[model samples]
Target: MKNKALYTLLIILVQSLHTTALNAQRSTPTEQINPYRIVERCTLHGISLLNNLDTYLSGYNYTGAGYYFNHENLRNAHTGNYNWKYLTTFSATLGYTKQQSNSQFTLLASRYWSGYHPFRVSNRLQLWTGAQIQLAGGALYVPANGNNMVSVKMRTALAATGIAIYRLPVRQHTIDLRYRIDIPLAGIMFSPEFGQSYYEIFGLGNTHGVIKFAHPLNSPSWQHTLSADIPIGNNTLRIAYTANLYQSKVNSLRTHIYNHSFAIGFAKTIYKIKRKDSMKAYSPLL
Candidate 1:
């Protein structure tokens, strides 16, 4: 009996020692699953030198000092008849950004201030407040049909506008799209080009209904937008010749406008950011 008890205690001691050794070995390895730590390791701070900073913001952010080549016209009652012309004006958006992302779309709230159009027209001096919505996110483009590269974007605002930017894969890098939206109007400013608002041009007669539903008035801009771009890239620099042409209707009258900017820009990957969801890799083991 004494011998048997000694053997049992010895076995217990050996087992405890083995477990302690195994635990110490595992402890030395510092196996961890910390997402914050991984994020810290990947954070890259600085401007992306290779990227064309000017084009980086794309349409979302207006240039600090913007120069627009624009065209506008009024047909009879601004719609029943169609008159379209353009202008070339120079101005700057108070708020500016030039950001480009590979996966997610960029959202920007900016003020468009310029009174220049390229097309020779009756009115040469024009000024107003406007906002721009652009697709600043990068995505995969699939060849859909003749002279077009197609990409899908889902927008939920005012009237959930669906935007499909079609790139006319011509040797020129023109990006075009036919799009539409139904959002209500918000934050409008038609102060004046130099202290005289549109109210002065048309008096104030049926301006009530007309004010809320026409160009210079009906900024309730919800229409399918079509844009185009041309390429001006070479070995040293990347240049994109870009143009945007859109036609949308309000209150049964079709309104159309065209804008094109010659942009020279490029971009390179900044740094890869590991998401928080990767922590789940260790979940099942728990």
Candidate 2:
């Protein structure tokens, strides 16, 4: 009789504890929900027409087709009481010249900090002036010439850029017009001496004073971009015309590249979402 009574007591105790646990769980919440905010990024890709002039070989000029890609991140901040904006751009180009039957590739990256100021001229016209620093590097190749088959170009410059923007409100849509120009003021470039053998520079590594500090007289470059952005739903179609003029004179050899291209691309804004309160716990029950 005593054993039976103890067994019965243990069973009742376990049942009571399990019911209490169930009640506690029901009273508490199951899961928590957190809100997230998004940050946007933009990218552009297009095609280009390349024009290259090499003075090394009897003033050879060639025209060809190429491609262009650009990436940008824009942020708005406050500097003291003034509004400030920052834009960083990375662009690349690749082309093939028909006459020389050669290929060239160039890459550029720049950052700008501007003060946002908008004034009215008929409609609202936005003007932005900013200081930019850009680094550029590229290579040009030519065949059938054993002495100098390749020309290596490398440069870094501090530049100033101006941007003019106007947006037109179409019927249930919008068109944006933008024009931007970048002019490099001063920088440095690496160029071999006229008739200098690459074997002496690369193989023997006689690289003293090969890098010259470039001013307006030695190196001058300008880049222009005019683009129109047409919005359709959540995507934007971009049509742009770009022109670049780059010239350098070092060691008595004059080299310049004139490149112009028309590009059609798509621009899309992407976002990254971050949870507001990741650590907070929420109730599953309504």
Candidate 3:
């Protein structure tokens, strides 16, 4: 594992060095156009319609808390045993971002979801799509349920992604594609007091595995999701689906269940924010 980490770092270092050398060779000592002017041709800040379906990728850095209600655990409170049903598990998320345009840094902490639900209102950032390399980290809190025994499950995950988005892209705007991974943060525990008892009901007889979660367990818990947004003028229609492809559950005492979501939502584009001064300075002259 250590060697693998070293190898990955080495590869990245080499790639960066190679890119720098290439950029040096391509450098033109002439004046560079203002980014804002180049993109300002479109009326919107950086959003337009997706005339062609190009690649889309988005990543946000998160530092918000959310609650997840495990229906199975709730059901066991009355049934007194484990089950295989996961319906509605809710979690709130808060994220920060240092965004990029093309291959350059542009925005820093431009926008984010609110503490409560931010979906009720129409946010322009939610409507368009673009391709980018994203890196995110966040936590999920599962409330403590007594009796049957369920701990406050905290988890974090990471993923490298590529997206093929279908939007009406007219300007230099950002968009969301699909969440390809919710990699298992670790082999979590579900109230050890009641966990062993719960495992017995699952026919495991006895459970023997790692008792703790390795903070950001660098394990293979890859997953995938699909979501789309169809634009109709300023308003849009959206539908999304997500599910787990791999199960890296480490429930030694209790049973763990994951659910698939098929959600239908609406999106609309509003006034785009003004272009930053730096961006405008880089725009090309007509």
Task: Specify the highest-lDDT model's number.
Answer: 2
Top candidate by TM-score: 2
**What TM-score does candidate 2 reach?**
0.74
Against the unseen true structure, what C-alpha lDDT does each candidate score?
0.28, 0.69, 0.31
Q: Against the correct fold, how does model 1 do in TM-score?
A: 0.22
Q: What value of lDDT does candidate 1 attain over all alpha carbons?
A: 0.28
Candidate 2 global lDDT:
0.69
Lowest summed-lDDT stretch of 10 residues in model 3? 47-56
TM-score of each: 0.22, 0.74, 0.32
Worst 10 residues of 2 by lDDT: 277-286
Candidate 1 deviant stretches above 4 angstroms: 1-197, 200-207, 210-237, 251-254, 271-286
Error of 3 at 179 (Å): 7.3
lDDT (Cα, 0-100) at 195 in candidate 2: 74
Task: State the lDDT of candidate 1 residue by residue for 123-198, as single tens digits.
Answer: 3222222223322111112222222221211111222223233434445344332222223234322111222223
lDDT of 2 at 78: 57
lDDT per residue for candidate 2 within 186-263, as digits (tens), equals: 888888877776788999998876799887787877889898889977788888887878888777878887777677
